[model samples]
Target: MHLILWRIKMSNDNLFSKAEIKYLIKNKDIVIGSFGLAAIILAAMNYGILYLIPGIILTIAALGMRGYKIYKIYERNKKIERTRIKYNFKKIKTMDGYQFEKFVADSLKLIGYKTELTKKSGDFGIDVIAKIENKVIGIQVKHYKGKVGYDAVKEVHSGGKIYKCNEYWVVISNNHGFTRQAKIGAEKLNIKLYDIDDFAYLLDFK
Candidate 1:
């Protein structure tokens, strides 16, 4: 419990906050880098190495900040990878429907798939559409406690036709997985069903 809480804290993600706005105001790399360049220009003046020293320092700091930002993103993705390995669905269940759809689309992108989220209201039945190479997949995302029912599978199966998808799927991240009827219908309709266990592979795309 302590470890999990610590991990979440270190992930630096909060439920709500304008972190981006704050970052842009405080840590704009272009502004810092420009200052560095200006300082380097002072090196040509009588001050010489004195200004040059601070210029190099600030330039390096700007680069290091950018690298750190990239590293943080890589670490965030790795945390998702760890969750997949641990088969932890509880965190995923906390997301709202729209959040769940976005999360699924983001995961697909990590593994080289180009993903698009359908409109919230007029999406037919699908939440996310993904493409890799020649294949187009329509996916319905469910982030619920109970087992996903047959209706979800049927809905995605039908939605796939509207979107001209080559494959269809119903994905649920909760532990309950899919009902027997859902599994049956998915098989008959050739629609894939991804329960908690099967859903883990979505992150790795393997």
Candidate 2:
């Protein structure tokens, strides 16, 4: 019988992505004992050394082992799929500032980014610190019901410099979006801004 081996890399972010686990399970090695035990049971029964009842019991046990392995793989796949679903972020009409930051972090995880929430006491206006493709990003989440102004942009720009991140972004979950001054400030500071629609577009949730 042919043999195969599969190993998944474990990390602090996650054990494996949904795609990786699916690939591994697809090539999972079939236990050799299935054919070997069945053949031995048949041979012993034919030689009259083993009774038919014992042969049937051993054959069932071998098959059970094989089935159990397949079941475990199925369970693992289900878990990974569920995790992927959790990252899907739809329209948010009402969420607090902290909730919005956590929601953004979940979406980033779907796209292969690891995120951490900064402490509220001394975060320097940055809410989320994301590491994406070896690039660190400082994000400020403003879940305002009204338009965000230049001050929000200024805070994120300052936070980015203090955190020493490669990139900086200000995301606002506001219907009114940003003011003209805010846009101009973001442009001058080279900071990315994401309004409600823009935020969804970035995550491809739209």
Candidate 3:
């Protein structure tokens, strides 16, 4: 049984992209458990506890279907620490550009860098600057949806020179992410792009 499941996962892992893999692993428990629980609730409301026993068992079975969520949550929480800044996807999606930039700065500082936010006016393009010993990193925050274009890559690349930054990055709220031209430009310019999924680990929010 275990061999068959392993073979199935091994075959399917090669068939899916990283983003798709994360989405499936991250949401599958919730989706399946929710459906099972709803079914159980409906059965309970319509019938007596005696008649609902099968439904309750099915819900518990579903909850454990993909490696019990209880263990998964415990394993996941074990890695979380008291980060300097706490953030979540829902809150991040609602923040304005200014708030998002500040959050980025705080998150960077959480990981040992000294960070500063550039002024709103006449700042050229850098939204945040992070320094650690001799290295300086320039960052731009975009709390927006849709594809980020080559222009954003250009903005940080040029702005990095002004800030004496040795590295450059763009933090984006949208996971759909950068345009093809933006990706090409980033590769050529040696800039990294962080969509929400990437930043989640970077920030290490609990």
Candidate 4:
């Protein structure tokens, strides 16, 4: 039934797929690393004292900024991890879809996954890209009330492949869980579906 439809949809994914942007925002380290290396090279080449002084100062400032950014990222992720353990999604029904996606990204961070929040426009149905070790995962967040239908499942499954992700997931906040058709479609595509129960269980991770 839905499984057959899933296969057909995936077969056409490539034809309909947009060019994958695969864009990651640059961090401060890239500039800092290059500047530091150039400074060392300049010093070794016996550059004039004026050039050496400014280069050394700029490199030091860049290093400090890089360190601060890394620490802030670490702290932010830790905060999210703690919030997941203490917070109950059922109690907070007011969060918008964007907020829900952020929560999901935070949970993945606790489990050693680095999450990249995709842009709202031209995201190709993916909300977050989670990477852990060598594996990359595509996740779509659904904040609806009723059962998650086949569309959400199909979108993540096909879009994930187009995005070159190794795995895909659909996170549905609906307590009623997925419809039978949706489940069948997801199973056919090997896409993991997470309902409210599964999210609760994740909070209990050791």
Q: Choose the strongest candidate by lDDT.
A: 1
- Computed on alpha carbons, the lDDT of every model, listed in order, comes to 0.78, 0.72, 0.76, 0.74
| Residue-wise C-alpha lDDT for candidate 1, range 1-206, written one tens digit per residue | 23433344455556324454444445556556777888898886766788898888878888887888889778757765675755445567578989888888887787789999999997889999999999999999998889989999888988888999999988887768888889889888999887655566446433
lDDT tens digits by residue: candidate 3, 1-206: 23433444566547766556556556665544665676678776975665366656655766676666677666545443222135544677668889989888887787788999999977778999999898899998888888799999999999999988999999887778999899989988999998766666566644
TM-score of 4: 0.56
Ranking by lDDT: 1, 3, 4, 2
**Which candidate ranks first by TM-score, i.e. highest?**
3
TM-score of each prediction: 0.56, 0.54, 0.58, 0.56
Give lDDT: candidate 2, residue 47.
55
Worst 10 residues of 4 by lDDT: 16-25
Candidate 2 structure quality by residue, lDDT tens digits, 1-206? 22232434333356778566655555333233444465666767685545445555555665676688789767655554454345443445556778888888877787778999999768898999999786899999988889889988888888888988988898887558889899889888888988755665556432
List of clashing residue pairs for candidate 1: none
**Deviation (Å) of 10 in candidate 3:** 29
Per-residue lDDT over 1-206 for candidate 4, one digit per residue giving the tens place of the 0 to 100 score = 23433444456546433222111113444455566668767877887555566667667877887888889777655654565557755454888888888888887787678998898778888999999888899998888889989998888988898889999988877678999889889888999998865665555554
C-alpha lDDT (0 to 100) for residue 183 of candidate 3: 90
lDDT, model 3, position 158: 94
List ranges where model 2 is wrong by over 4 Å.
Answer: 1-91
